[model samples]
Target: MPDHDEAVAAALDSYQYRLLPDHIHSHRADPTLAERLIDSFLQQLARYADRRDLDIHDTLAELHQQRIDRGGPDHAPEYSFRLGAQVQPRQQPAGDKAGNPLWRGFITALAATPDGQAQCTVRIPGVNQALHLTTAELEPADSLLPLPTRTAGIVIHAQEAEQTIIDIAARLKRAAGNGLATNEHALADLAQLTMRLSAWSGGQPDAIMRHLYDRIINAAHPPPQD
Candidate 1:
């Protein structure tokens, strides 16, 4: 039931978490592989936009804006992996190409080599020496932790709240159409809701939702006069 944008976002997230490392690892020797992959991905995105009747240029612009809003290319994973992030070797190091078991480790440091090539220093447990590796040579360690009960509950509640809000708006529309409510009042209410939703600046959602909840409760229960 997701809209085109939501679906596309989900697909991109999946590709990043699931397939990107493999693609990089497989073409580690080819320095131009990242550019080629990006070009191919953009072509695929254009095709998807065409099929969805979306303007490809606008979609690209929106994506670029989002990246800028998210701290720009400096924060991109390709530029620097977060320190302390768990990672495993994706490619064997030079002179250690006996196809031995790759050790999982935590990124202890990040820096560029003399030639300006970015690299990570990973600390493997029980191993005295740390491994210096490029981004293409490492992948995030597979998650082994179980989902927290509280986190799961919050997700379920949020989904239910989203559906309830949609249903309430739909019923309001139906009531307005049937003359059970004034068109002017209904339009004003809907417009206010839209404005509030649009005013959200990608901060904590609970804050805005709580404000709306207070407004609804106050409207339903007026204060007593002296």
Candidate 2:
């Protein structure tokens, strides 16, 4: 019988290749299995963190920092996606001078490979793209290629929608500038486009997943060996 850790890792791997939201959602609905998978994955991540003398919260924070750094050597290639929960602006008190309040949330990012470690890069120049993880650095979760949510029901759908938006924006950026565009503007455009697309479809989750699995993944990865 497969051990629980193996089972959890397998489920996480499945997320990487899952091509459709319906397929993911079909599995996720009322997820007794997902719960087990999630618990096990968290435990594994925790263990990895402990081995590093780190914590899960800290690890997630490091991922956030990596996004900010856009990883790599000085002037080396770097990139990341901007997505995640957003805080709704609270209504200002009637007596207050300003009507607007600030919104806040976490956004994801990926640092590109540093120059000397070109071997770490998985490139598709035709797609005008590449991705990298630090040399010898172990990741508890996948490198945010596809953001998997642990939540269920509407929350899960929402997280998936957020991920799709990020993926689509990335595609549009490559299409527009072949990945040479500035990261700030590119991320902004992606945010706007994802929000619009999500609203337009009333959150038809599968469209985003389909576009990514069918179109984007090829551009992100190298061709397989003959």
Put down candidate 2 lDDT per residue, 1-226, tens digits, no spaces: 4365566556665753453335444334447656655666677778888899875785576566554443323423443222332212223335324543222222233344555432233221112123333422211112312223222112223334445454545465465666464556445544444444344333323444444454455554438889
**What are the lDDT scores of the predictions, listed in order?**
0.49, 0.41
Which 10 residues in a row give candidate 2 its minimum summed lDDT? 137-146
Give candidates' CA RMSD values in order: 17.7, 18.0
Candidate 2 ranges with C-alpha deviation above 4 Å: 1-30, 58-86, 90-226
- Scored by Cα lDDT, where does model 1 land? 0.49
lDDT of 2 at 132: 36
Q: Which residue pairs clash within candidate 1?
A: none
Candidate 1 structure quality by residue, lDDT tens digits, 124-208: 4334226798765666553212211211122112223333334345555456557785556444444443333322222133443
